[model samples]
Target chain A: MSTAFDAAEFRKALGAFATGVTIITTKAADGSLIGLTANSFNSVSLNPPLVLWSLAETAASLPVFRAAEHWAVHVLASDQEELSGRFARRGIDKFAGLDIETGVGGVPLLKGCTARFECKNAFQYEGGDHIIFVGQVLNFSRSESAPLVFHGGKYAHATRREAPDAKPRSAALSGSFNEGFLGYLLGRSHFQFFGQIRAQLADQSLSDDDFYLLSTLTLRPLISTSELDAGLAAVLRQPSASRLPALAERGLVAQLAMTAESDVAEYRLTEAGRDTALRLISAAKAVELEILERMGAEDGAILKSLLKRFLGVVDPDASVLWDDPTQVAGKIPGSGWDS
Target chain B: MSTAFDAAEFRKALGAFATGVTIITTKAADGSLIGLTANSFNSVSLNPPLVLWSLAETAASLPVFRAAEHWAVHVLASDQEELSGRFARRGIDKFAGLDIETGVGGVPLLKGCTARFECKNAFQYEGGDHIIFVGQVLNFSRSESAPLVFHGGKYAHATRREAPDAKPRSAALSGSFNEGFLGYLLGRSHFQFFGQIRAQLADQSLSDDDFYLLSTLTLRPLISTSELDAGLAAVLRQPSASRLPALAERGLVAQLAMTAESDVAEYRLTEAGRDTALRLISAAKAVELEILERMGAEDGAILKSLLKRFLGVVDPDASVLWDDPTQVAGKIPGSGWDS
Candidate 1:
């Protein structure tokens, strides 16, 4: 059967079954620590507490595992990718310079895993080029951290899928936007997010555009009109000239002395503006904390990472708004902006 | 060793190791199809292409599987959750009204899965209360579809995590906005998204606020001032009274006849406004397609779903902007808004 099958294709097919990463560890008879990363670990029985993992017959740790009375499986967490890679290497002291705990039969246990299963080696079966070791679980512990996933020869993240019943709402009328629209989602999210901070803005009698201007002012001590326009280009459709005068009149911003670099003139957030911006920002951060709490930390991280990537592709030059205002002059040429 | 361990606790610990869902199927001696969802499936060896899965000894299909000479494992795709659940249940015809393909030894193979392995049952081991059956794979195939993940007793979606080296850029100065900020991410994403369609707005001689007004008109035939204000409140900070007259002067919007129900008149898109908006929307959709293409389809869906969830938490009332204007009056009270 093996002679007829393509080994590479077989391996590729096996990779399709995504598995949580695990570092199986044990102690050699000579008292040396031994471990290797494997995704083949799986639970076999609950009543008798059995779990199993297989190791290549030619592996250096195979002899150690075969002679060991016990071994432990550390289910890697999303943050343990480096540890997974460390144990996967050859001819290296995987446990050197690390904290470890001795489990059943002195098997070294790695910390910060999603789960730790300490087991006594119970049975070994010949599995072609590998040996399958079934273990009787003696003790175990689990954590709430998200598990690290491996699929198609790459690390992945698993997000709790929304319930099937939570379907994307369709628009009542045709040609109207629905929840599925990326633009609608982005716009609505922005507005709703700002909506949380809007109370603070209202207290300060600042509008959405005013909030935008005020926040931009917080990015630097004194930003020239040209710099402000360029930085806020993607956000504000109306020019800063229209909103700045009002903020200045309200004493939220103050004009800076003309500089030798240019006569464009610059504006800085006044003391009151700084205090208001800080207060509003703290409130906004609180809103973010609540929203992220509801969305789960893992999903929230993935969402932000993806949004940054999307922004990278769509608005590569948009980051200039937050970049050092002085460096903006040199970055303008390759900023990928047509203007 | 098992006597002291709680079965439920052990099972909970094992659940921490996420596994892709699989439906194992085999033909009974009577030629009847037998299938059940299992997450115990794992690759055992590469040389002989061996894979293994454990079945509870008490399972009704245990005898059938024990006697089977061949079986198939179907690694499910993310979209196959319902099929997974259907096969997980007992006392029902799991194969009812479905297309099925026969594999080795006349074993039934499920369709639309991430991968499939047809194998010859080669070995069985005593695994406490379960039987671990090892198979020598004779044939297998795989698809690029994202695998269905099972973790902590629920189905999940796996998204390719960005490499750890790709960290978010930190702010140049402390206490300033960077990619880590949700408001910055959302604002940048929205602006950059609209930036793609800004050219169309420019071609139509429309300002950003004009584009917003024109697009809002596309939602309904007749939008009242109050409805428009409420709907676009998070978006447009200025009163609709200021923007409406300007739009009407430009013939992009028109004041409808005042109704007996309310003194406030309604407005709708003019023919030119509708045409411009439709054209701009088509352009925006193209940008969306390009963006989604760059980001894999699965991640794109997950990101949008998460953003929608986040919006649901922060601004539950924001959806009214897209709701039918006629229905707005009745929904205002419970719209999760103070006004």
Candidate 2:
């Protein structure tokens, strides 16, 4: 282990400490704006309001920050990853075309940060290869935006942890159903959410299988029986083969012209079917919006992100359903994924 | 905003920059262990392996810390939240029963931390009401455990973010089935996961509704028809009413005595039914393990945590299905949740 104590390992050890991404900005002696991405910023004191961040001694902006009387630290928000990337890069104009606010000593302040601190450069201390700059915060402002996290040498999402007492108690029966099971949570969330949209379906006289078939058909203007079956395999109990003909009989669906390339029949939603599908979809979207609002934006985003990652891990090949032409261009006739 | 530059506001702004929790430990002049919880630690340089953290001037151990020649910084893991709390409190024997390793200068080093840095206190700088101690690291180590994050004054879970290029492309047809939709993700994830266990159900000659009934029945030893219906309402198309009687005929379930309070008959899993349910559940759990393993432990945990939170927001009342007696003490007949 001692033999492996190299620079890469040292960096890896340091990466274990997660930190929020920040951009420290200052105005140079010649009035040029200088800024760089950093995750080393931390609050040092509360009474007199002091914060500290470090810059490499050989950094291009070292002299500018050294001579600066005042600077600002902008804590990037979750949505500001692109801005963080911009400032972290070298030799590019970081502030070009950006909406900025001038802070104390003419330091450039970026917009939409989760928090910003305008500070007087209090002291600079020497370190091995960096200059530690401590600043007395003169003024600051903050918003409720979620902070952008950096960990393990990559960007990450931070979700609030549940209080220990808030965790759901186990069920009475051992080896029975665990409400905390991933399967139960997924199933309950899906069914409960769909339950809210069931009334609209009932008003329209649409069955569960019917709604599944109709929604699957909307993915493309024309879908072959084979492709439709593949997509609806998980949600549908009855085959689309039997359901499509009934929808065609109702004039809600129509069969498309057969391409000589294959004998499989293609189907498309008729005008009535399209209208019915869209109305119910809008209602489903409304239910989604209501539930997401209850969960709040931060958690809602985290849930969706984690679900997407889970899907990627469990169903990597399911992308064909979304028809990303790159994967299934020739597989689907007249695919418009790229078009 | 300038007029509101109070301590609370300043603290709020600083909280916007998330940080990993750490416990800085040192040995007092009298050989007592001194440790405190902090999130102000940051790495300042690599060449000299320097790190820094601040101690409030008013802290009880300030005198010991100022005189200490060496200290250790332990970056807490996600499971170390309780330990962090313990060290944060005052007037307690913080290291009373802990297994500690003595580092340089007899500093107490903690176990199970994400990272540990043993450092020689090299410099002390004054910052308003705090003293910033810069340490040159003499030795350090790191583990792969996920670090505990602090954001907005609360502990948070940090999950790795997907690369921008890795996000799934939007569907070609806009208003159709978006694979990225939260509802679609929930539905697809649930269905696909359950799809794996369907083969076991089929082998057991059970339909989807029958399986749902069987699983719900396992939640309690004796579940009344009304309570069972409420539980299975979401996942089952046909009510447990017809399914339970059929299961009884198949010798998988049995009807219990009717109470004078109501004419409703309760049902319990027969020995055969219990065996069948357990077999299927174990199979489902196997599938879950496979999928979660593929997703990695870190992402799997984050996924489950987020899903649990999602369920809390969408279906707080669903706890009754799990038969948490505190929530539905008299609602279910013969509930043994607390047993």
Candidate 3:
């Protein structure tokens, strides 16, 4: 408990997580509506034409956001970090000095954006410390302009100029990758694909040794505990510790066999473990496809990992400012990223 | 024309495009090496384990990164923004006074990172302002730690706790998603899956409208432009723009003589256009799958749009930083992300 994670510390970790810029809105008093800037927005469906974005526990726009006939989500342009900053702040009368206007859902639509999505409230859900609002996008639009960038914790515009003269690595995943995951292979010529699995077991934390055990399970499942170390090392591509017995003792894994000579220890996904692994894999795959599409098919592998690093931010339900925008949107200055 | 996209303007715009965090290293003078921070890393393979990352043009660590035995990528942990910041700056010995170590490929390993990937140079192409270094990740390791984030050219971390309390909207793309493009949908999920796609298109840029038109043609061939607009509007949820007979007059689409009462125009992929569309869509689909695998299923949607924003980073070439860590290593300030 002494090494407790603090807000600033965790914020540093979480900000590494990526997110989409969205604005949450609802009708206000005096016959008009109010909205706030956010990067917690997400899409939920295509069949029903639905969308979703999250809010913090500290948002000032809550009442209005919850009180509208329709709230709209404007997917900020890559150059709209200022807009994201403006609306994310509290007590600023967001739309007062802006050139925003209302559209289909009568929600505030920011100016100079890449796309606008007008929606009616579809559903709301409680997630950990945040509120998840699902918007049924009633109308949407796109522009040729680029959206703003939100990396780490800063706001930036796009560098539309041409890149320098050298060609780097190919983005194709298999036979073209050199690192972690999303390396490449076959059948990717025309179709998009992704998948994985996730679960919260063992306190939602696993050690390097623990991860080795899991990867071993992925590569070769069901071996005796004694042989697990070697198997894990092989599959893990590094030297591994003798981790089987401890894991088994904890019931996170098992021996499950009898007879001394024939007795063996192997690694496999526990019911909970399997569930989590699958979920994680599925999520990773899903993002891989997205990066390829967005980059228009360049650097498929890089985008996948980049997206993976920002997972926390993308989850949206996990933020504090989700409720009160002002505090969350405070301009702490100093390059904004240097925690 | 003096303001026709100056370097600073492009740099500002490029800053708006968020990226992930990574460190690129090169063997230093006196048989040692230097490594610095970066957000331009990406994945490239799976079967043989390939990956890529970019280095910026003005980075101080270029000399060593260009001469390293093997470059390793340490996907920074969310709690490690300080580490990202330190490495991103110049004038200090990056590897001094830290508990840093090295593993495979003789590459320096940052402590407590989410994962470490060791790679052998696979491909190196020059594009625009960055040098793309593709590596074949010979070995890799992972730990259950969160990663640092980058946004708007700065580092950001999350403010999440293990338990749920008074947060606002749950940011999880958790409940269900409805409003999205198969284009947008596929764009996010595929790469995070960390799978590979074999593509056949050469590098080229297409307008958003053109990309949509081409995608439509790839999905449903021979549909007229009007039907395309209607279909696209349905997909986009945006009202179709008012396009008069001028398109037909310009032969972008042609009038059908089959209608006696009215001349219904038909839009078909031109022979050249068809070839181009087929090539581009094929390439786009391939990349989309790669991105999907990278985004993962849990935060799939946000990853979709997030990467969509990143793609707008202006690769300077059709190629992007797939996972090499060398393309943009020296180019921007603040290590090119939220450090």
Report the CA-based lDDT of candidate 1 relative to the real structure. 0.82
Ranking 1 against 3 by DockQ, winner: 1
Alpha-carbon deviation at B241 in model 2, angstroms: 0.9
CA error at residue B202 for candidate 3, angstroms = 45
Q: Tell me model 2's lDDT, rounded to 2 decimals.
A: 0.84
Candidate 1 interface RMSD (Å): 5.3
Q: Higher TM-score: candidate 1 or 2?
A: 2
Q: Which run of 10 residues does model 3 chain B get worst, by summed lDDT?
A: B175-184
What lDDT is reached at residue A187 by model 3? 13
Candidate 2 segments exceeding 4 Å error: A1-3, A167-172, A257-262, A328-339, B1-3, B167-172, B257-261, B328-339
- Give per-residue CA lDDT, model 3, range B20-85, as digits (tens): 567665455565657778665543333344555556545556556666657777777655667777
Q: What DockQ does every candidate get?
A: 0.47, 0.55, 0.03
Q: Model 1 over residues A182-282: C-alpha lDDT tens digits?
A: 88789888877877788888887877778778777887677878878887787775788888888889888988877688688679999998887777777
Report the Cα RMSD per candidate. 4.9, 3.9, 31.1
lDDT by residue for model 2 (B1-339), tens: 232699998999999999999999999989999999999999999998899999989999999999999999999999999999999999899998999989999999999999999999999999789999999988989998889999999999998876766535554466665755788778888888888788888787899888777887787778888877787677778777778888999999999877788799789999999999988877777777787887677667777777766666666566356646675654433322111
Q: lDDT of candidate 3?
A: 0.46
Candidate 1: where is the Cα deviation over 4 Å?
Answer: A1-6, A90-93, A96-99, A167-173, A205-227, A241-280, A316-339, B1-5, B91-102, B167-172, B205-223, B245-261, B264-280, B316-339
